[model samples]
Target: MSHHFDYPSDETLDISDAYCFAGAGDAHGPRTVFGMNTSPFGAPTWNATGYYELKIDTDGDYIEDITYRATFPIGSDGTQHVQVEQLTGAAARDRTATGMIITPPNAPIGQVVECQGGITLFAGERLDPFYNFIPYPVATTTALKDGTFPDFPAAGPASDSFANTGVRSLVLEVPVKITGREPVHFWATTAYFDKGHNTWIQVQRAGKPNMTTFFDFANGTAKIADYNGTAPTIDLVGRPAHPATDPATGIWGQVRDNIAAVVEAGGTYDQLPHAFPTPRAYGAWAADRLLPNVVKFIPGTVALWDPWCDIQNGKGIIEDIASNIIKMIVNQDFSSGLTPGPVLDYFPYLSTPPPPAS
Candidate 1:
């Protein structure tokens, strides 16, 4: 019901990514769409400050230098208005500066805003970068269970969980100077700006919302390090009663730090950039009955025949196509990162073809 981060194990979460440099709306552009998420519990869209940022490491050791922040605030009409700012000099060093909305857009949403300094932040819908299995969350267990997490395979089909349903996302397109804060081998994380007095607190980083994901203390342990003990440490589900505490994690603060470290150390992708493979990766990872139908569907979607979404078939149809062909791309010569693929370029967004033999 409330906002929360998507999970790595959930069948419906959109946690995939690619590399990129600059950002844009034509998304016919943008170097890459590294990650995305639209949790499947399905909530109507509401207002939330969304942003994408990068931590620059002008200094040594790959730790974040000054962090760049982008906040997306929507106007009453629902068009995305944006603000961009850097937390450097006295700003980042001072905790007090963190709460200041440094770059408020002037002239409102007239396609331009003098966002602090001279950075002009633009807001609008671009082709969602993250991809995953769709319609498969509701699919049969056996249907989606393949390359997905070992214990859960059926979570294969990935979809842009956000769609139009109101997943107000925060995307930050940092210039290479800033993102280089980490090594090419550094880390990436996504979070919402805490508007509450305790706003600096990244809630998604603190404790994910319940009913949104199957990830927990143990889920992190198995995939990465033994951060949590042997049993699954489900968080925030009942809360207050069960309260989202992790005894293995000593204090709530430690849990967040522990999770970030685990993934960071392992060089593994977490939460967003749903990079992990699942049964939904391939079109056929659906239930047996639907299995025959994926091959029957993708090849046939061009013929005006669509896959079914009901119990018997049509399970991972949307998810598979989006990932395999829709999201794939090759990096530019500069390694600016992933760009739209030639195949996606050739195909009509409906049913198109790969570029002619390159």
Candidate 2:
């Protein structure tokens, strides 16, 4: 991750952009929360500071209507003090008006650990809510032993592996009204000011805000949001696929089933690349149906989706599970708008051209 930003439409996605937030499972992992420590991911850049904002435009006209900010402790241990604000237009640009600490009323016990100056801080371990390689001897592997992929999710129930992680998680959740919709396909990135260098570096935490890194799948590939950072380009494992033209008619079922096959091979990996990213369709499918769109009648709402962290609001899982269900129903017909449930929606663009090293 570098301090520079990638502009897809000669455009960049950041807290300054419309509709965004930052999220991670188990904010108190030793390097990461349990089950997510597989990689020392989301490490802050040099002179990392703890101030971030969630910017969003409920309607994609490109005008940011909401701004939510989180301020973290300025030293090591990521103190996790946070703040939220409700602002409009130029008012938000002013640190004074736009920045106000509000209590996260009724929020879970650890949801907002503290609130100072409109910043409600919640920094602690929540379960590794994002569904990763769990629920099977191999990810994507189904109990349907006949060789055909299972008609539905193979996992008997959602389970927390409790994988130990060393990194402390940092994030905040803004209301849907702030995001402009109850649900939307949003993206996230982090910036840290290296006081020593008197500069700030950037990191695009892969997918949408509050979403687990593993949920950005679409057609066996994911669309990583461009970032403003100074870290090396991260690696994405598994096969990559081209973007799809329409959600109702794509080649995703084959992708999921195929991925299931890959996971089944060597039931428990004894070699390299055992764990891989989930197919991209999972994220895109959910995004498409839940986020507002001109394609179908019901905009900004999915008919069915029951996935959440129960702690910090696992927005990504809500989208991914809907996508997986639709995949099973389609039986490999990526295109058939008759979704069993809403599927994930993919990002309009993926990975940004990384900035130069410090």
Which candidate comes out best when scored by lDDT? Answer: 2
lDDT value, residue 232 of candidate 2? 16
Worst 10 residues of 2 by lDDT: 30-39
TM per candidate comes to 0.38, 0.38
Residues 1-358, candidate 2: write the lDDT tens digits. Answer: 0111222221121221122222221233111000011012223321124334444434444233444544433335444333344566765433345444464533332343444322334333322223322333233233212233443344444433322322223334332223333333223335445579766444333222222222222443434342123111111122234322222312223333343443344232122222223333333333333222111111223222322211112223223332333233222322111212221232111112123335
Off by over 4 Å in 1: 1-62, 72-81, 89-95, 99-104, 107-120, 134-199, 205-215, 218-358
Q: What's the residue-level lDDT of 107 in candidate 1?
A: 30
- How much lDDT does candidate 2 score? 0.30
What does each candidate score in C-alpha RMSD? 15.9, 14.9
User: Over the stretch 1-358, how does candidate 1's per-residue lDDT look in tens digits?
Assistant: 1113333333222222212222332312222111222332332331244434433334433334455555556678766555555776446433345533546643342233334432333332233332333432222111112212121134533434533332223233333333332222112233443556554422222111111222233423322112211111222221222122223232222233333232333333322333323212211111111111011111111211112222221112123322222111100011112233212331111112112222
